[model samples]
Target: MASPAAAAPSTRSVRLQIPRAHRGLRDGIEAWLEAERDQIVLWAPVAFGGGIAIWFLLPDARGWLSAMLSCVAVGLGGMATGTGGRLARILAIGGLLCAGGIALVWWRADRVAAPVLARPVVVAFTATVERVEPLAARDRVRLTLLPDAGAGLPRRVRVNLATGDAPVGAGEGARIGLRARLMPPPAAAVPGAHDFARVAWFAGIGATGRGFAPVTVIAPGAGQGGLRTRLTAHITSRLDGSRGGIAAALATGDEGAIASVDSEAMRRAGLAHLLSVSGLHITAVVAATMLLVLRLLALSPWLAIRLRLPLVAAAAGALAAIGYTLLTGSQVPTIRSCVASLLVLVALTMGREAMTLRLVAAGAMIVLLAWPEALVGASFQLSFAAIAAIVALHEHPAVQDWFAPREEGWGLRLVRGLGSLLLTGLVVEAALMPIAVYHFHKAGLYGAAANIVAIPLTTFVVMPLDAAALLFDTVGLGAPLWWLTDLALQILLGLAHLVANAPGASVALPSMPVAAFGTMVAGGLWLALWRTRVRWFGWLPLAVGASWAVLTPAPDLLVTGDGRHLAVRVDGGLALLRDRAGDYTRTMLAENGGIDGEPALLADQAAARCTPDACAVDVRAEGRAWRVLATRSGYPVAWRTLVAACRSADIVVSERRLPRGCIPRWLKLDAAMLRTTGGVAVTFAGGRVRTVRTPGDRHPWLVPATVMPFRVARFDGGREVRRRALQRRRD
Candidate 1:
């Protein structure tokens, strides 16, 4: 009924509304960019780490190189045009940092490239022990051996030696000859699991094996393990068994000495960090050294006035930190903490506050540059997250106001200190939650409370006692100190077991998506780094990430890398198709399914119709039943049985490759197929099976194309080149 002119006005208004909304969004973004000019520098590590992550995701070096080049080109172009505003400049810097990160990690990987073992073979050689690391099994020790150059093997090879047959005390610089069957390092057990082969590759280790023949000591080099070994022996001898193991670990960074049962208890109760020599240990060492040396120097007033006491004391602390780090094996986490502690000493010399987010970022950049591969490691992630969160919380304006010292009674002061400790623990736990969930697939509910007591006990009570024991052992009076250390460790171990036994100590969460993890990291960094009110907006991404992590369903089916083990979801729990799977395999599969316990055997289930050669079962998922038929026998099966299973089942699995006549309705997995995929995880979404394969391509340390250790792809003169098959290394 309205006139055409009235309708034209209404349409015009609607069109104008869109532009107005667009304009508002643009203006808001511009304001945010402007406000964050100073804060954006803090994101350099994030940008750098992003590029490193992308390199790992791509299958080949060319893809990563091409991407890196593209980023550089885009960054340069952006820099040229960034005269417009701070936003443009920020984008340009981000691009360059990302390119730099990718380039650095790629260079590192290439530099560490070594020849991989082509096949399993028995070999005997006299090799020097480069390093000796303790394993969870007390009888086993991991030895890095430098084989003779004529052997045509990689520079370093790791072997797990049994104490029964191997040398009694193998340590650094010892030469030994042994015959062992060596094989290439292995891939993950299932899709989305940790890849030890890739880690081994970056460590310049191409082969791993267990010593089968008795180890013969060919030549014992000069004082192998030296002072560190003697110290470890003294600690362990004073406090034997698990107590000694914990003490030795804290003193010498020999974590493998800890009993597996106690380690698991500590891990589940969230006190495992105490076993690792990292920030807290390094901090205590540096602080105690500085204080003691400063007091001694201050006793002489003449020297105190002549020399800058703080600088002199800081120098002493720096030396102690470096020495302690080396004594403790110079591991990645310990080195990271050492670097940060040294930075604090540097700050002290310059009369500046050291505990800042900037310091954390700077230390990360250094570590990323030196050991770029560590960026993806759990130790790097957890250590950095905890320290960064604490520093951020310490610097918060609100926290500062609430924690300010006031004229109050001892009771009020003690209460305030306890409250502060509780708050810091909560903040650290929250910051580490996403990372823990991503890597471990579980979240410890009482980790904050556990840390409140364990951290102080380890840092204050136990470390000092352990150190005193070491000092007094030279005079043979360390028994008392060692006794005290043992008592404290017993209390610590008791707390670990008690907390681990509590109901809901840790809740298994579904496997996390990479996107969700990245989002959470961005959100956390944003919330921690920025001081403006706008920082509160970071909760949006955090909430989004938490939701995504919670909603991502567990895999319905998992196949092991060796094609011998198959786990399927059934009756709201996981079930192994066979009972032959090892404990490690069973635990990994359960973790993949977000289940707390090992999988039940399918053959033992009441409804599963399984024979000596085959197993057929029905699993309900996404509101429909899926029929899965899998072979049981390793030998050949009846042709008619295979055909029947393939025809009737929704999915089919076989130990041997299927014939053309055997086709399934949905999916099929056989030995031949599994060889290429390494491992496979199948999930149902919207009534469709979604497959996730690991080591998806031949990436240096993954699936072998031929009998060679693995198929490695590389770029040569802008063209993909192939390597001829290698012959036997020891003919």
Candidate 2:
């Protein structure tokens, strides 16, 4: 045998055996990290955003004392940042900022919330209409109402009014009086679903209900909102046809005018953003206005030569953004886009090249600080994700090469332009993929191709005609322009229908767990905010999150908030237990689990035997069974149903009170239990079942339900009561 020292492998030999790819990757990461050391500061804002998101998901603090503790944490974080090295100081500063952010949101929520009696209360209230949206049904208008003083309402409340005969348009301000039954905002439809109540609380809305009678217009022209309403009405009337609604939506941001079919089509085709007043529309308007102003001023050589043309154009662009914002009713997204544009214009005017990342960060910061609750909403998340991803990836060497311009003849140039559009669409779709799937549980398979075709048509033809139509109407010369707008809209709608109807146009995905979504967000942020090759580490969480989402199991049964509606998974489809075909929530849940079409159409998919008194689902495919029963409290058969359900069903759901004699061994959720849970989702696998509530104590927006007093105590002031007491004492 060889000597022991020679027989053992030398450490040098092991080092020499390392793979070339692994060594190269390690070296690249280190080099990138060293080169981009200073760019680490950009991550601070992302940390601040994390704080906002964390606070938003936290349940309402137990009391003011917890909020005060949050304040103390903020002060401590500030102190830590004061005594540290450069890296340590940066981390401390981010922590301090995060604590401060949490405190700010907590204080804002506490101050803004207005308590409402749980029971319905009828009141005659006078309020200003901050905004109005017409319902798809045409019979109602949803009004964002700001009550006059002493209305005993929050700063804002949404009320549904029956139009009766006075059609409500996009009027932003008109004082009106209404008799309405107001109740606390509705809770989440299912446990862990989006919490509308929390959203309403942060939005300053205390209550919501239908109007008891027709609204009275106390002051028709008192507020500035009527102008927008009139403009929208004029546009809709002039373009009157199938495409008129679409034209109005683009021109006035009155999306309610679009029919349900058209709306769904656009959404499925991934062209929904084009229908809204967003950054793209605002940017287009700004550029066109700037060019027009510059050309007009250049006609006078003295003005053009003496004045800074670029500065003047930037100022004009800012003004155009403001005008567009107002025209679109100053919705949150429109205002946010305006803010971003203004920031860029101001930077340009000051002779500075605005950094795209800085612009995005500033815009996001402003929006989040002003409306912290928006951090939890899908719109805010999706919009920011798109912008941030684009800014982060656009500078990659690979991306630069892909987007490089080429010199070509006219025909070749046309082909190149089309190819560029397709690439852009692909990039945007990729950026938005996670968010779209997490929120909507579906992604358009044909989205990239649809956008490639639709975007150019909308940007070049439809929007330009819409602008011309608006101008013509304003100046009393609109009929022809309106006709042209209508024609362009028809073409857009046809494209939407075609793409939406294509084979494999969209794919349904299972509901992503909250943890998986959060991990993906963190990964995306890590990649976007860092400039080091170390950023490649982000791929780890992203890959893991995607795998988790793909492997997550779907719930076996789902119940609605009121416990009146339910769905059971059978085969691969959901069997709806309710009578109606269009319960929006149920339909959404079904589609999320890859089920489509009406409940009646999917009847054969489930082995459900339902009678008037009870329904039983015998899932032969999975060898599982469940039963549900509903009864009026006074009916004797209600007791029978309960007893039968307790004895025979794997799960029992009772709409009325439980009977006195039944003790159920199976999972049983009653109306009383659902009142607290809001909704419930149950999953069954391998003879075991798990349940999750929709509402939880962890969400900051959720308001704990108050315990109602059993009885009212009062002092008696009646003369007969006093006399009877005195007489009884004397006797």
Candidate 3:
């Protein structure tokens, strides 16, 4: 019924609305980018981390050459930037920082790579005990030994001496002589997994092994290591069981003392971080010290007025942080906390408010520059993420309102306090979720709930009582205080157990792709580092990453580095190839494959037909019937079984030498191949086989690949070159 002019106006209105909406969205994005401009400076480190992560992900390509090239590129970029505008200059600066990060990792790796012993050789040597920890479950005492001068050994060596007939005392200054089988630190169990060798390289530990007999005390050296070790030993010796284990772990940095059951419970309940003396413990100690100092100063009017109460409290807090660091062996996390806390104290003395992000960024840079390997460590990632999230949450106006003092009523104050705890716990748990899934392959479903109880208990009751107990112990009056501390810990431990037992306390997740993890990191950083409605755009990448994780495919086969075990995908779970599987194997199976249940019980679940000689299992993939066989070298495996497997099985796992003519058109992982590759993960898709190695030849610790035979492919106007595979060092 409308006229042509009316219809024209309506069409025009729709067209105008489209552009307006688009313009508004564009403006919103730009405004978000412009907001908190200063915080954009923090992206320099993020870019640097990205570069370092890239270096880690890529295979080693002539280490020294790559390092030199990176350095040169950075220098060239810097010089070239002088001729360009602001955008170019910014890009150049980012490049320089990123290149610098890569170079730092290379330099650190080279500096710490001492000559490793080639084989497990029995060596009789006397070394001073720099530090000592006992592993009673394994009937051995691990020692951080400083080899004597001219010992022709690495500066620092960690040796495990068996407590055979006589128990070895971990007394500092004691020079113990023992014959031990020493070998280089073990390699990574799976590719893209934790590299113990790299960790040892950074820690200055060149070798690891266990003694065949008990260690004999030969001489007492000067400056017996740390008083804290003795103190922890005394406390643990008295307490015994899980109580002593948790107590000793809290007091000292020796978490090995904790019982397996208690540790597992804590882990399941997402309370495992409490056992480590990290940022939380350091903050609590410093905070408690500051409060105590402030109260003491307030009690004396003259001192409060004349002494500068805040300065005194800050100084006390700094000293307390330093002492705790020392007591905890000056570990990486403790050192980071100490440095950050010192920064805070310095800010207080200068009368400048230290922004949390600035302090965190500075602290992270310091740790990375000092220990570049920490960038790969889960602890570093989790700790920094939690701190950043807390800072971001605090800056929210709603959070501020919720936390603000309610002068009207005590009930309101109580509600605000409880809300604050809940929010803090939720923030930390949410921030750590991606990291937890990537590293441990599980995100604690009830972690926030667990933390609601654990955080308050840890911050107030346990920490305070433990600190009081420590102070009392130092002066030989700790018994009653220790009892009180024990009671508190018992309650905390019980809570952990109950939470761990709760239904759906934790959810297993497939190993998230590296790309997905990187995306999530970018999203999380964007969200946490800015303050604008547009910052919510970070959720876009986060959601995409989450979707990718949910859809990613898991590996179908896994092999252990030692070639002593194999796990094949079966019936939506992994089936064990061996009669008995180790803890490491089980954990890797569950984490990497997202498989449930126990390893020892998995062999039967596989419905495998076995004899002392060999075992065979049927597999069906993509409408094709397949067979898998497991056999030992010396076993009298029937020829018919091997022949049938070679014909019908898509994959064969065996240590025995196969017949020359009976080779399968499928995949074969023999002992010799496993040795070369260490461990391997395999997947099948689109009727093709894909494999990934555990100790990929590209790692920094692995020997450089030797130039050998190779082939090149040439396409129309391009040429492709094949890089030779790096060989593993055979023991």
Candidate 4:
């Protein structure tokens, strides 16, 4: 054996020779450098152009200038790094110039239209209806406020109308003039709720209008035109006499035209997405277009050139998709699909392979920067997740063979199709579970099953029939197609109805806090993006979030019916209303607090025990108690009773004016007390007793009691006093 000193020399010798042994590493580094140089030359212009566009779109001048300066810094840094090529320098300079141009345009636009800085004025304006829908029993109409004569008039205003009339169409631009309140557009609800304000901003709507007036239509303005209008009109005509309008809605994002019953059926089945023009619809359209284009090319040798044909077809399809997107008002899901399609078209135009993952990422980046708030929207998150899953599954090697069928056997095709459907369902469901739980507080357990059946039927039978019917209607041959579309719609509705009524169709989850929702979304996104098995770690946060939501405590002080007894939220504790009526109110309170009690018994006991003049109040638990002074006449006697009660009782309350002799401990029940009719509350150090007048007045949800002052309570010395002069007048 060699001595320790000898072994050290041997180890040193091996270390010294290590670099020589791996001489190929140096060559590999050189090769990598060469490849990077080529890549930089290719991507330099694209990156520079994108940066410039970003800088231009920045909302503030300071940001725009800073971004422009960053371009210069990047160029200098490239030069200092000693790897800057002629292409890199040229790209940098081009980027800076583009940024400057963007800034100039922004400045010019800003100067041309100075910000309106006037107090919100009530103005009488006439608007033309663009879209209308029922929102929570009220009509919310989006309209274009037609200006009398102005170069820069606010383009649109949303009107909330209290009309019992039917919904108006986009083509029927009714002139609605009203003296409406105007305000600056509000930020989107829930951070990512659809930014109608931004959409209106793009359309030139600076102010929103409310209320309605009798209106007339001057003439039919330019209705939706081009293929979009034609397609929508065609579908509408075909589905006119159909029992089920869902098919037409599924084919075109026109749920407004769908019957309420069919719409509810689909919603219950969790197949409402079928009616919306989403990723599934867009993909179907794209696939159909591609197949038709390929077949037409194959049939015609004269136009079957390998070059430009595919690109041209893709471009046409993309344009059609974009038109459809606009026709559907460019909802987030539709916009996402269009963006992905456009990316694919660009790749095809450049003779590059279009990868789904890359397209999804690019679409996401674009949407986030353009509408950062969309990150919180359910549609944005779910749409992208579904598309990403489909793309990934489509690329998997195990399923690659299914794409290329050896023989067109019915069984083989059916199996392959089913397999693909299952794959898609599993992937999308897994990806969206966290989001569904977080935002909706409910998960459709059978969503995958419903989608499996409904998606294929929708793509193959319903949409095609609807589209064909629309096409036939344009050429005066729609009578036969109409019947066919109707049959297809009925079948679709039946499928939805069956699935919705299936056992365990959906499960309600507990509501989650906003922070937990954010965490869940972040974790899920991380798992989706991760390339390793460690992705399973995402489940930890999801489980934690679910647990937190499930364990959240219930709220306190749930009062039901008008001036009824409060049902203490404690288990088995029951308080009955002074009035024996108002079961609806009692039930509402019970539901709100998860209270268990017999309302009838409590109400009977309360009514029997408490009289108009003298009421006996019980205190089962040691706490403050309230006494209401009741009398047939004379404020002096009532005031004396109230004063005596206040000595022993924690609080004294009266529906009538305070007696002339009594003084209040606390004068004037504040705005907070007005919210609850449980009588003016007298709170002790331990507990509170509320005294509410019977037959409380009803107020609208928006109106706050802070604007009103209590007329009954008056301060006299250190006590409350009510004048007998007013009491005798009432008697």
Best by lDDT: 1
lDDT of 1 by residue, 665-690 (tens): 88778877776666777786554333
**TM-score of each predicted structure versus truth:** 0.90, 0.84, 0.85, 0.59
Where model 1 places Cα greater than 4 Å from the true spot, the runs are 1-34, 82-84, 658-660, 685-698, 703-731
The C-alpha RMSD in Å for every predicted model, in order, reads 7.8, 9.0, 10.2, 12.6
| Residues forming the 10-long window of minimal summed lDDT in candidate 3 | 722-731
lDDT of the candidates, in the order given:
0.80, 0.69, 0.72, 0.53
Give residue 208's error in model 3 in angstroms: 1.6
Q: Which stretches of candidate 4 lie over 4 Å from their true place?
A: 1-124, 128-156, 160-176, 179-213, 217-220, 223-234, 240-248, 259-261, 305-308, 348-355, 393-413, 553-731
Q: CA shift at 153, candidate 1, in angstroms? A: 3.2
Report the Cα lDDT for residue 44, model 1: 86
lDDT of 3 by residue, 1-731 (tens): 98888767677688878968677765665455556566767777776776677567666656534754675576567567563433444566676777777777877777776666554555777788887766654555677887776655566778776655323454667887766667777776654456677777778777787665656778764432457757666767756677777777777777766777788789889898888888888888898899999998899988877888988899999999999899887887888889989998899889887647878888888888877788888988988898888877886888877697767688877777888878888888888999988888877767777888887887888777776777787788988887887887888889989988888887777677788988888889989877767679899999888889877777667666665667777777777777666776777776777654554433475457766556677766777656666673343446775676677666767665566544666777676666677666666545433334434445656652112112212223222211111111111
Off by over 4 Å in 2: 1-34, 60-86, 121-128, 136-139, 146-156, 165-177, 218-225, 581-583, 592-594, 600-606, 620-636, 686-701, 704-731
Q: Higher-TM-score candidate among 1 and 2?
A: 1
lDDT preference between candidates 2 and 4, better one: 2
In order of listing, the candidates' clash counts read: 0, 12, 3, 11
The TM-score-based order of candidates, best leading, equals 1, 3, 2, 4
lDDT of 4: 0.53
Best-matching candidate per TM-score: 1
